[model samples]
Target: MTVAPADDVTGEYLALRTGAGVVADRFEAVWIRGADTTPFLQATLTQDMSGLAAGEITRAFLLTSKGKVRALLWVLVGANEVILLCDKGRQADVLRALVLLNVNMDVTIDAVLGPVIEVIGPTAATVVGSLGYDVQAPHRWAFSEAGHCVAAIGHIRVDLPRFVLIGPSSDVVRNSGGVFVGDLAADAVRIEAGEPQAGRDVDDATLVHEVGALDGAVSFTKGCYLGQEMVERIDARGRVNRRIVGVVVGTNVIPPHGCEVVQGSAVRGRVTSTAESLYLRAPIVLAMVRREVVDGSAVTLTWDGGSAPGTVHELPLDTFASIS
Candidate 1:
């Protein structure tokens, strides 16, 4: 769906003024299923899939042999099919990798690049509620047989279920009933929630724990999956060395991605994402800081333009939680 300007804002719309959802700028959808589904995925992904039930959504990482993440994926399990969602740019590589690894397995993979639409807000439920679909708020995935839609709310990744509304973009926009948030607003919400974007906050060189996703994507109890050994070792060591943490910049001058986070003369980490917080009334950021520097300590963000003083805070960095 596309965003349109509106003068009249409902409580739902007001909610969306600060609240936001994602529009599938571009994505690749792939289907994998068969008798070897569990084994195939178990061997390739970082999460345990043997217990995944139909209608459940699981986040996982496709890792290299050396245990570095190659792509972040959202797996949606249907009665007889498992759908994999990955970045459009990485689709070909991921599909190729999976295909090469599908040795004697009874699994099949097909790249389905369709229009994926997302809708989120506090009134997100109200919008979906009007559509005659009951979507459980985030982490829960549901499909609309009649509307040809699939949705999840409040999910760290794939926060909204994408609907395959085969028609004009305008038509889908009208039908979605939720506001079409810009890329900036979406990034802001993601940072506030402490979620990592695949390429921006994580990439091939990123270990799962360093991105603050060890608990969500990696399963320590699962059998050996790609990159499981290194991930397990990091867990056993009781530290990840470097981690993604939130920083509240004192000034409005936003630090660009990869800008250095400094304390005294030492380089502590680098900024991965930054956005203005409508709720918090200050500039907040997500950065990959050396583990030693992330203990709610004060620091400075140095960039080409200037420098701003800030502090390192934990993820889902809830400045509001303390008050509530």
Candidate 2:
């Protein structure tokens, strides 16, 4: 199997870190509309969905009753409708779950089909600003062939400048003055940036806190929604059984997924994603490890019929992490 989703992972990674790269987006869009759009979403999503003026976006979660993540959502409060971004393959599942709980609420949930483009990397803001809008805004939308075009902060960091341009057209991507990076390369960049991909680093079994999404994705002040109780419980507890973390394998080869992360003979956790980090110039892996294994701890990652000693690290990895 390939270590990355792109043929030229190293080049794509370099482009984003140093310059700019227009990444082809694979995420699907969900359009939620009606008079009750604001209140309905306010109750269900983790973000305070009210008072979001037009051209603003908020990261929110649709969670299970047990507080496991159903979907990591990015909500754009538009004029005609409220747009949601969800996992590409599992969008129907997201919509179905939303519809099931949407009783007595005047909201319409539907899937949007089209190509989405993300112009990201350090120079992402420059590329996006040239396209005729402020890259600083959290939520903004335009028009396109497949659907409405939207721009927002691409990832969860302050230092790295990243912006996502979601629309039906590839024209904006071409005109963005950046080399096009595919999903594989984008995945590597995302992993390096500590951005968790749903169904990979996180799943339906994933609690919001496990991936460290409490401050950004889940809202404490918002009214009751599905899975609020569990979220609050986890918040009160202040830690999780296993939290996502970064690992630096001794081997130069990228660690394969499903590799066991062990401390002594007991399996503490497992690696979820790994990549040949261009910035670190070493192989890095993202693992879901028990909370007992503190940062800077030593662990063994067994993969590909061999085992390598790896040092534990915090999220956002090392090379691309903000020092300031």
Candidate 3:
């Protein structure tokens, strides 16, 4: 991944110049419109919208009544509209859930895809900057006045990198001035950041607080949302039975998702995702480990016919501190 100076360029434009190639990863952009938009959102997600200003973006979770995550969303609020970018696989389900809950509200939701292009990498901002767009510093998401473009600086998961999403594809590529990075590379970046993928790190059986993303997704002061009670209860208790952590493996062998994590003879957790780090020079993984065993200490993974040495570390891994 290439690194570049921060200036007027956006991440997307910078990615084009770097070696990152773009892929047609399915993504949906949903528009939230109606007088009840704020109320509707407050009741549906874990983030508080009471203080949201236009152009503000937040990371949040859409959950089931059982407190399990249905989807993870990156939300951007506008003057009269709120936009949601969620996993393509769960787009329909999320839309249906929102519609079912908006029976009496003045809100309308529309799904949008295709028109947007996702450009990602460390130098992504430099490419956009060259196009005359001023990107916000890393970890924050913002939109540029260059028509339909949104620039975000952060990790995809375990990989802390910058990314930009430009819309109306035609105009975006023409002006991006950078190379395109495919979804595979993007996925690799996420694994490097140790950021949890929604369906992978969090699913129908996963709880919000267990992922160490409460600060990014849940608001302690937010109004009641679908799974607010359980989340709050976990927060009040000061501990969750399971927590997501980064694991650095001793070998180049990458573990598959769902591989059991073990410490001696006890099953501690399971691997959620794994990849070789381009910058770290080792294999890293994101795993859901028992809270009691999550200290930054030595651990091991037992697989068929083999064992790999590893250690449990915090989320957003140390590699991300500079970018995130």
lDDT order of candidates, best first?
Answer: 2, 1, 3
lDDT of 3 by residue, 1-324 (tens): 233343322342324324343434445667789888988898889988878887777778888987888887877777767888776577788888888878688888877655655555555566556556676655455556755646463443445344546464634455454454444345555655556766677778888877665566788886688988888788789887988888888888877778889987899999888766555667788888898785678888877877788878775554544442
lDDT (Cα, tens digit) per residue for candidate 1, span 157-224: 33333332211243545645566655666666667778777778887888887866555677888788
In candidate 2, stretches whose alpha carbon ends up further than 4 angstroms from where it belongs are 1-7, 129-147, 319-324
TM-score comparison, 2 vs 3, better candidate: 2
Error of 1 at 71 (Å): 2.0
Highest-TM-score candidate: 2
State the displacement of the C-alpha of residue 221, model 3, in Å, after optimal TM-score superposition: 2.0
Per-residue error for 122 in candidate 3, Å, reads 4.1
Alpha-carbon RMSD of each model: 3.8, 3.6, 5.4
Q: For each candidate in the order shown, give its overall lDDT on alpha carbons.
A: 0.69, 0.75, 0.68
Better of 2 and 3 by lDDT: 2
For model 1, the run of ten residues with the poorest summed lDDT: 159-168
Worst ten-residue run, lDDT, model 2?
1-10
- List model 2 lDDT by residue over 1-324, tens digit each: 012234666677767777787766557778888988888888888888777876676788888878788887777777757878876676888888889879898889888777656776667767777766555554455443444465665566445656656653666445656767766566677777787778888898988888784676677886898889998888898778989998877778677788999998888999998777766767888888988889999999886678888989887775455422
* Candidate ordering by TM-score (highest first): 2, 1, 3
